[model samples]
Target chain A: MSVTGPAGFRAAGVAAGLKASGAPDVALVVNDGPSHAAAAVFTANRVQAAPVLWSRQVVSDGRVDAVVLNCGGANACTGPGGFQDTHATAEHVAGLLGVSATDVAVCSTGLIGERLPMGELLAGASAAATALDAEGGPDAATAIMTTDTVSKQSLVEGDGWSVGGMAKGAGMLAPGLATMLVVLTTDAEVGPEELDSALRGATRVTFDRVDSDGCMSTNDTVLLLASGASGARPDPVAFDDVVRAVCADLAGQLLDDAEGASKTIEVEVVHAATEDDAVEAARAVTRSNLFKCAVHGEDPNWGRVLAAVGTTGAAFAPQDLAVAINGVWVCRDGGVGEDRAEVDMSGRAVTVTVDLGAGTEHATVWTNDLTADYVHENSAYST
Target chain B: MSVTGPAGFRAAGVAAGLKASGAPDVALVVNDGPSHAAAAVFTANRVQAAPVLWSRQVVSDGRVDAVVLNCGGANACTGPGGFQDTHATAEHVAGLLGVSATDVAVCSTGLIGERLPMGELLAGASAAATALDAEGGPDAATAIMTTDTVSKQSLVEGDGWSVGGMAKGAGMLAPGLATMLVVLTTDAEVGPEELDSALRGATRVTFDRVDSDGCMSTNDTVLLLASGASGARPDPVAFDDVVRAVCADLAGQLLDDAEGASKTIEVEVVHAATEDDAVEAARAVTRSNLFKCAVHGEDPNWGRVLAAVGTTGAAFAPQDLAVAINGVWVCRDGGVGEDRAEVDMSGRAVTVTVDLGAGTEHATVWTNDLTADYVHENSAYST
Candidate 1:
């Protein structure tokens, strides 16, 4: 089972002592291809990780040949020493692969403000380089796991081209543009400009819409590396579509795997006067703890839904609003309408619809129901 | 014991059937005045309650002789009918007290979007009026309790001038000007202009610093009515000083009664580049769930404290930051310093200090730690 999305890429995953559990803590993916064109998105949080800083600087030239990722310690808030460690890690990877240090991007996620174990990390990198193979993509995906229960990997094959990607995150996932650590590989011939545009467009609606908890991470990074090995350059428009499809699929996986989550909720805000209003209302519902808890309990509490909507800055008369949960019209014209007891929630997917009765503009956001496990998991960790 | 602090105001509290548990739910305070001058502040949430709307309108003329308060059914999101109920409640109070309708202010809290129980509410209002006496302030304070373990009342008396206030709220309390509902009566002779100025100044630093939870309420209101009954007029500066002290004391009481609150955490952000930066840093700490939980468990997790500060918009070099928990400096110059085990948290008050290393600006915010009870209580009810 080759983890590489394209024909000309090799991948490796290995256990590093950085993780206390001795799980595969390091993953390496390299482009053995016709082009090194790449584009990446980093966390918008002002308090960024050392890897984020290094990767951001590496990708500024629109070229990247490989990416190195490790789990167990997010080298964030470690001050100057952390930044030095990130630079050294990239340099070591570049030296082993015979590539320029600037072409090597790095990513990490785990505990914040913890220093990387340099000896174990370097040893893991060396082993990863020797273990890289064309058929090791699956193992590489599994290596990046932190608290994730399952590996998130998706491959979309088009005519003479393919897009492959992997994602890892269980909490602190709020979509500002990207929410988790993801690496996308493709053999499709595309330029950096096209890749940037496609990634932004895809992430805007997909990864950016899934808000597991409202906390933003300091180490989130999403990088798309094009090997361009197939020499079958598809139309830019078509290539963008494939990129979006891959992102959407991976985003669904992240939401489904949200920590302590029982259901993946889709909140659709339609008939708004403007797209901003639609997005605001959708995001408000997605971030509401009470609304999320009600969903977890399988309770159709439409009154709480209306209250969340009312708190948004969007202008909508309470009387003009309507809401539906799980396809049942539970509220209409701002008051209770249908019998809420009729709605079922035996499945893992739930849908909430809001009709603003303004215009045709619409937006949808993905979220998970709040559960006791969420509180338990978060509160148990002193840090 | 007379609840009036050198003032000649009659107050009373009585049980109304508004609460499901049949507890005392109504309170009235009337200033028997030689001069009736008042100022009021209300919630900034776009979605306003009926009482909030009515009070805002009534206080526009700057004269109010009495205040009517009830807990258990917050007439919010009840649409037009709710607005009518608020008007009727005020009108009834005014009619019974032989005061002008425009001279009365009303406030309600508890479940949102519910209609007032007119029959029980009216009967309770009549009873409260008949029971009103200058020494019934403590009873009035107890009447507005809803899930609160204790009644919050504060009094300040000096040189024949006095200020007395009562407050109610345990959750959904975050500061804009006021989080919960508050009523203040003063015997000092001050015009409406001076009263408004003093109230705003006092609340800016006192009630505005308490953040029990990040949830903003739709029915929060604070009204100050001056009766000039003591026949002693203090200067504007002296009156403002007394008002500030009273507000601070009342704010302390509110924080002590916060829902599921084990300890009151005061976050101080010092040496910020600007006032906004200081405030933003303080708010970031106040809103951090992880930090709150750490404090609850009596763990001095300074790393989480820095992480919380890093999320703020304030500009600062990580290497220039310092943090202290309960007077024990745990991190200095952005690196871990003293052992976190040295900090003691056996008391009910915990303090966190952050030095932004930007300038001399500073700010303080009061918040409660996150406990299992908070999750239990909030998850058990619908907004």
Candidate 2:
């Protein structure tokens, strides 16, 4: 179960002729709710996709009746015609569900700089609406995938309600969101303001901390829909916790399925003057291609880590920095410490700890190692 | 002829057993000057190598008698002992040249975080000093080699004066300098102030614009020693032009020799609000791994180019950005224009031009494509 794990939600996934492999490329999730409260986050990239522009307006009023997503065409950089296509898709979906077009959100993923095949998409949307079921969350999760090898879904139960979500993405993962589409649903009775606040607080630390390849996408989206079908007015703090838990679980799945990644790296920055400084420092190290390659080779090359840290404007003296690979302190006081051979890196998970020795704030960024497969997959993706 | 192409300069190279391959790993360049006016620039990275710390102080007085450079050990992150080793090397070179140790500059490049073998380096310094000759510039250039396949040398002549320089680096090439050491000698009668100004201007547009993999090294040094042997003070503008020409030539060579790169990409950002905006836009494109990989695969994926440009704060509307690969405009007004198939990417030299449509300012940045060999080389370099 994904979005449909919560009550008062129905979802369906249908095969559209958009993807070359004939995989399911269209999904629909409708909120048959007593209350229609929603919140969303879009990609920070100024070159946003057609659907993102359409959906940003749809969710602006803090109410969303439904969300429709498609893979196999990013529909970005397609100009006015692309925007028209996105608008037409939302209108078509709204007509079938007896809702206003302004209440429907649209999301798209895949290659950029191309137009979508509207004929197959509209027919697929009709099929998805007809096949909507309360237990179709997994199918919806599977449909919104581009390079993802597996569907991502998570459910967090509160006192008498639950929060559930689904995510899809592989590459182009970085700060300000990635090439991922996430749809979250909750049965708790919450207002639009509370939903928006909870969603922002959750994603700021979860999806926002995942950096794969440091490539920001033009079609990233995350939406949360709330319905009062559970008749549970849970505490706002508990609701926020459940939302964050679901988001964290989905983010982890995205990292686990990152494109061509052989190792998952967690770059932890500690003892920073501020939380922003810690995040900045951690992100700098996570974005270092040299350091990622070293991790792939299983070499405790702390010099590359320190070099990356030196590139940031964070407050910390170079000589006061210390770094550890796994559990071994490979570098202390900015110099060689423990024997590099003692640090084992054969496992698929690697942790690098950097102590800035500045203050008490800290942050951890999730990333993946750079491999030849990553280069090969991305190089052959569009052409 | 390289550094020794000018008068009043002697250079020598010798094998010091520091390199396991039994290759030459030590070089000595002496300025037997009528006037020893010198200026130098080191890596901007705060975690600099010990030699950079020593050389920064040596060049503070605007005078340097000699420069001794070694390969096979960067002597970085080796604590106070590393600084002591650099000081000792400078002292040994100064003793041989009968000059103050403060006037002797030291440079090192190789694996970081390891102490250098001082015994072998000292002995090699003695050998290099004894073998110094006026025609040994090429030999000295060959000595300071790590992963570089070939030596880089360039000469630019003026009226009865010339500027000659040698450089060594193949990877870790990015803005704020790279993992390179450069020794430049000129027979022009110029003061230290003029030399410093000309060098800064020349390098700002030359070596500083080459970004390969976006990894800044801790051991980057560029030194220019002016010897008034020619007794010819050409126009400062002409002298600056010669220095810039030599630096541009060497920068080109570095791009050509970038590790595992099959294509040399020149990203030109035109019609920017300011020169800084142009440079920032160009550099963002150059540092994009996805764009680099697309170039490596011979794919005219203009979407990646625009995606990179969107990450910058440069003043440009999404609807006004246009990109041209080679001579064909593939994107116009942020949308697809010409057929991408019309843009040929079969050549080793690829040019990507982005028109911001904001102002008249422009800039160009040189970079290399990301490839499997690049990942392989960096992954296995230190292990």
The candidate scoring highest on TM-score is 2
Task: Quote model 2's TM-score.
Answer: 0.99
Task: For model 1, name the residue pairs that clash.
Answer: A3-A137
True contacts kept of 1: 0.22
Model 1: lDDT equals 0.83
User: For residues B333-366, could you state the per-residue lDDT of candidate 2 as single tens digits?
Assistant: 9999899999999999999999999999999999
Model no. 1, DockQ? 0.34
| Model 2 alpha-carbon drift over 4 Å, by segment | none
**In model 1, which regions exceed 4 Å deviation?**
A1-3, A177-179, A293-312, A317-323, A327-348, A354-358, B1-3, B177-179
Determine the iRMS, in angstroms, of model 2.
0.8
- Using DockQ as the measure, the top candidate is 2
- Residues forming the 10-long window of minimal summed lDDT in candidate 2 chain A: A374-383
For model 2, residues A94-207, the per-residue Cα lDDT tens digits are 999999999999999987888999999999999999999999999999998888999999998999999999999888888889999999999999999999999999999999
**Per-residue lDDT value at A357 in model 2:** 94
